[model samples]
Target: MSDRQTSRAGMALALAFFSGMLSSSLPTPLYPVYISLYGFSASQIMAVFGVYAAGVLFALAFTAKVHIRTSLYTRPLYAGLTCVLLSSLLMMFADNFMILILGRFVTGLGSGILMAYINRSLIKLFDTEVSNTAALTASASLILGQAIGPLITGEIVHRGFYALKTPYIILFILVVMSIFGIWRSRLVINRHCTTVTIERKSVGAQSYRGLCFRDVIVCCMAIFLSWAMASTFISQGPTLARSYFNVASVQLVSYSLSAFLLVAGISQIVMRKKHHYSSLKIGVVAQLAAVLLALSSVHTKAPSLLFISVMLEGFAYGAILVGAATIVNMVARQSQQHHLINLLYIVGYVGNWLPFSLSVMMDHFTQETALNAYLILCSILSTCIFLSAYFAVRCQNITGRIRKN
Candidate 1:
């Protein structure tokens, strides 16, 4: 295929990937609407969110060992897109909590599968430099979709509270278009007769045990901490905004969420040149600052401070995620890279699940108090991540010196 053709095909696949992620978060600003309309409690609302994480976990654990085949990416991609379409329809028509959970769970499952497929396909399609570019583009697309989901949904929901289905309708149409885009791109690639081959299926038994490596553990922890903080805001921010700041407007909720991802994406792009460990440390510090500001916001009930906290959280997310991926790639065996990445995401989604469990606090304490507790938890996790990275870097240096001696 020509360079231009490959780029275009890459962009098309990127869009499809973005569409799936966008649908995943399209409900961020609408959780309040669900509570009001479906008469669900905060805990139940969180359970619905948790179901999505559960679906992701289900996919990760079960599919981690699947062999990668070139002709296979489209199947999961198509299946995931279909699951997202079904999810949108169910959510649009949902009148009960059960249906809502089902919808979110299916969407999570779809996204989990697609997320794994797309990353592997990138390796099949491009060289290291080109694949890295495509990977960053896809990552940014995922963040952009997360940002756009709330912004668009916020506007729809705020304009007419009863019109909460508008965002799903829009998402449904986009999903359909994305599915078609993928189909067309696939046809184009096939027409070129560009065949993808898996030279070897497994790296080796030794690299399979590479999961026990200390640096790998630290990178996985980094992914978990980064995503855990991001999920906290998405799952609980709306309720906190309404209860604490009296800013119940869906638009503000959506915009704040959007700002978190937008800033994070930009941070990743701007700091792409920095050393991975340096970026990880700074990211951890930024997350700590976010938690501190969050505690202050809870006390002062300052919306601006809350917004600033979210922005800092975004910066931290971008840094830690990129840093973790880079560090893992540096240490991962070539043939075992896919397995290592799967492990990272499995841990990451577990981080996503933890914050949603915080909804139990709603029964015992005020929302502000519960949120303050959540921020404290995030602070502790951030500190652990920083220390882990510090020691991992130290170990890497000591090992290098030992080799020299």
Candidate 2:
């Protein structure tokens, strides 16, 4: 393929990936609507939210062992897009809770496949800096889709439009357009240069084995924690906010969640020049602070404090995501890049799954108390994880010096 053709295909692939992620989170703001309409308990709502993560995990596990031809990314890309389109349609017409859950699960599966492939292709096709740029571009697109879904959905619902169905209808249109773009651009890569060959040249056998100690493990843990915090806020924050602040407006809830995601995307772009480690440190500290503010906001019933916490959480989300991806890029061999990315996502989505337990907690305790306890636990655990990563890196550096001496 020509250079121009490759670039166009690459861009189209990224947009398709974005569309998938957007579809995955499109139902976030509508959880309350569903609860009202269906009389869903907290457990049922969380079940609906967590099912998507389960789909992501299943896709990642299945793809980890397989070697997908880069040239064939478009086939699965469209298939995933079609799945998302079907999911949106199901959500639009669903009268039963089971159907809604099914829609979310399908959306998750579609997003998981597309995200893994897009990240793999971008890293394989480009150089370090170029791939990193592309990765961030794709990540930002994911965040943008996430932000836009809730923001638009809330507006539609608040304005008394088709409410639950309008968001999916609009999403249906976007997916169709994305599919056409991928088809028209002929988004295929050169299969002759496989990721496996690149991996062999990038890292030797011993260095590859040592990945468990240095970069991949730590980055994965950081990503897990980051996504845990983020998913809690995105998936459950609206429910908690309504319970605490008597927030009845869907638009406000949507704006609040979108603000967190928008800040995350913008912060990543603005601080694109910083080192990954530095970003991780700053992000962890911000998350700790956000947790404290979140606790205070719940106690005092202060929206202002909650807003501050949201912004801090955004910083944390952006930093950890970029940091984790950069670390994997720095440490993994070329061939392992795609698989490692998939693994990292798997870990991250596990965090998303963790918040679902709050439904059980809320059953026994007040909403404020249960949420506060969860936030505190996450903060303390995140700090410990950060410290562990720090000491591990320090020990590795010391061992390196001893070997040199």
- Best-matching candidate per lDDT: 2
Q: Residue 380 in candidate 2 has what lDDT?
A: 83
Using TM-score, give the best candidate's number: 2
Determine the C-alpha RMSD for candidate 1 after optimal superposition of all C-alphas: 5.1
Cα error, residue 99 of model 1, in Å, equals 3.3
State the lDDT of candidate 2 residue by residue for 1-405, as single tens digits: 666776776777777877888887677768888889889987798788778888878887877777777667667777788889999999999878799889888988888888777776666555443235655766777788777776677678779788988888888988898888788775354344444545545643222233343567777777787788788787677777787777778668767777888889977886567666667667777777887888888888987898788889898889878767766764644334468878888888777777867767898998877877887788788777778677765665666566557
- Model 1 residue runs over 4 Å out of place are 34-44, 129-131, 161-165, 187-213, 241-254, 293-306, 329-333, 356-358, 365-376, 398-405
lDDT (10s digit) by residue, model 1, range 1-405: 677766776777777778878887788778888888778997898788778878877776666777645565677778878988999899899889889989999988877877776655554455342124534655677788877876788678778855668888888898888788778778543342232223222322222222236776887877787788788787678877887689969777876787788889998886567766667778877877888898898889899998998999899888877766655543433445566766777898778777755777876888877777877887787788778877767776666566557
For the record, the alpha-carbon RMSD of candidate 2 to the native fold, in angstroms, is 4.0
Evaluated at residue 154, the lDDT of candidate 1 is: 68
TM-score, one value per model: 0.81, 0.83
